[model samples]
Target: MHQHDRKIRTIGLADVSEPGDEALITPEVSAALATATDIVGYAPYVTRVQPRDGLTLHPSDNRVELQRAGEALRLAAEGRHVVVVSSGDPGVFAMASAVFEALEDAPQWQDLSIRVLPGVTAMLAAAASAGAPLGHDFCAINLSDNLKPWPLIEKRLRLAAEADFAIAMYNPRSASRPDGFARTLEILKEAGCGERIVIFARAVSTPDQRIETVELRDARPDMADMRTLVIVGNSATRRVGRWVYAPRQVR
Candidate 1:
């Protein structure tokens, strides 16, 4: 469709998904973004929904949030190949929508090339490393109270526990959102069996990553955060050396 027979290349963006960690960006992602003349990444709130440093903001919001939105808009208007990096899969709790939402009014982005490549979501990586924690049906919920009300999150946690479904917890704790995950754990412990296996997996596939298995009643509030993944085993979950496995053993 090029009258000059020239290809219009856009920027390739990779999901960063984690704070203070770089392993989330794989070689495949680098190669794609490398092709661009310039690449820009935006990290979402891992623990508490906030922005990071080096990003500017639009005055009315947090500096980090403002900077992230402003940068993408600026690059897009310049007609440069702009790739917005987000943590985890862009589609999951990442920046896919935040980028689009910020630029929705600016139709200039309409013709610009935009692509979102899939990356490792924290939950998936955690579940994999924690054995078969997700081998059966499960649910994932973020425990941040910034956007959603605590009541809603609490309700979901209660429902997940009562249903006896294995659950994955994301954004479980943060400096400001401290009590979200702790409260959820309490609800789960009361609704589910005391012996339920709770796998605390942190920084999966990263240098500081640590994974542990404990009982639902044993999980401490001080032990988790937005960077951690809390896998609450259904009644059948079991622990296997730095990992948790939920089996389908037919009786």
Candidate 2:
């Protein structure tokens, strides 16, 4: 059915199947699934939408984000109820920005009804699993240097360290660029964050999930992989029982 002809509805979905799955999709997201005539996303994310008789799934490779966004916009302009799925909240280093970026160049698609439904992002889920290291001021950084320059990434890391913000690094180490994360560790250490607490939360909320905390001095580059979300606590962050958190107040 065409989106313009039918009322759009959203429902929350439960993620009881795995530890981290619940945060991945909500009932509102699930409800919207029923109204979708087409779902477009990365292959893995699109696979999570489930296959229904009338729903069309368009899964693409990881690097073609702009192209994917354009395709979604095209489908939507054609009257299909398209749901563009991103792993976490689309706005956070995901498809939301890409979609908008595409829309900006193609003004004709701007009038199409578009809504970005929110979802639990990786940093929040990682922080929750480790108490609240992000209780204070924090920043999330995408470590991939594909689109941006390495110097800019380095500059941001230095500034974030100087500000003492808890840093959450996504896409830490991937097969293509293995040394970037190693360099990240070196920069943090040089910025005098060696004694801070670092948490490596991998595949969080999933069956194979793993969480590890350590002093920055002892943290190694190999501890993280593409699936891992790395969080570096501020100087004030500490360990309490099995959890780690930064106090709401600063000295």
Candidate 3:
């Protein structure tokens, strides 16, 4: 019923760890935003986007990934250039999957132009801030129990520990579930990983950023927050000068 005749285009934008890393936004993402007709994301994230004359910003509450994704797709279907913003790499526990899920429910938007622009992820940024704790085999886990059960999270922690994989934990602690991370530490300790090097990288790439290195046994649950990305280094992870990294070889 609308008068527009342009092809629908929905560009999903992945974001950096925090606003302090705005300089790290890829050139491709910046270009896409330049022509974006609408930007949709969590309130704080949408605030990161500079306002313009021809653009509309849709800010929503947290935990509404599917709703937000649908809104973006609907906007695009109306011939508006939509950009759905997410934290870190969208493909990595971000908006990309949610958007696709929405698309699956609405086949009308299937033919619309859809693309995901990558950005700096907190895990990689955290790993880099502490040299290369993930230089060896590694895995990233979201400690939040929003989508998955706590028992499953515990099981993965145990398995990852048994595999001797350097683990990067996302959303390690939150106000609503402060004890989740505390239990995570306990599980890791029970799995005989008490001696592993643990890195608490919070607000990385930001002015308030803090990267702390400590042994797993010494790492406190309070050391992490919702903004923190915790990386548990493997047995080979060690401190070189002031940097902590997993050695390239493990023989």
lDDT leader: 3
| Candidate 2 lDDT tens digits, 101-187 | 888999977678777787778888888888999999999999999989999999999999999999999989999999999999999
Ranking by lDDT: 3, 2, 1
- Clashes (backbone N, CA, C under 3 Å), per candidate, total 8, 10, 0
Mark the 10 consecutive residues where model 3 has the least summed lDDT.
Answer: 3-12
Over 28-138, each residue of candidate 3 has an lDDT whose tens digit, in order, gives 888888888889888888888899999999999999999998998888888888888877766788888888899999997788778788777778888888899989999
Task: Tell me, by TM-score, which candidate is best.
Answer: 3
Stretch of 10 with least lDDT, candidate 1: 3-12
In candidate 2 the C-alpha lDDT for residue 8 amounts to 19
Model 2 is weakest, by summed lDDT over 10 consecutive residues, at 8-17
How does model 1 fare in lDDT? 0.64
Model 2 residue 231 lDDT? 98
For model 3 the TM-score comes to 0.94
lDDT of 2: 0.83
> Of models 1 and 3, which has the larger TM-score?
3
lDDT of each structure? 0.64, 0.83, 0.84
Error of 3 at 143 (Å): 0.7
Q: Roughly what TM-score does model 2 have, to 2 decimal places?
A: 0.92
The TM-score values for the models, in the order shown, are 0.77, 0.92, 0.94
Query: Candidate 2: deviation at residue 208, Å?
Result: 0.5
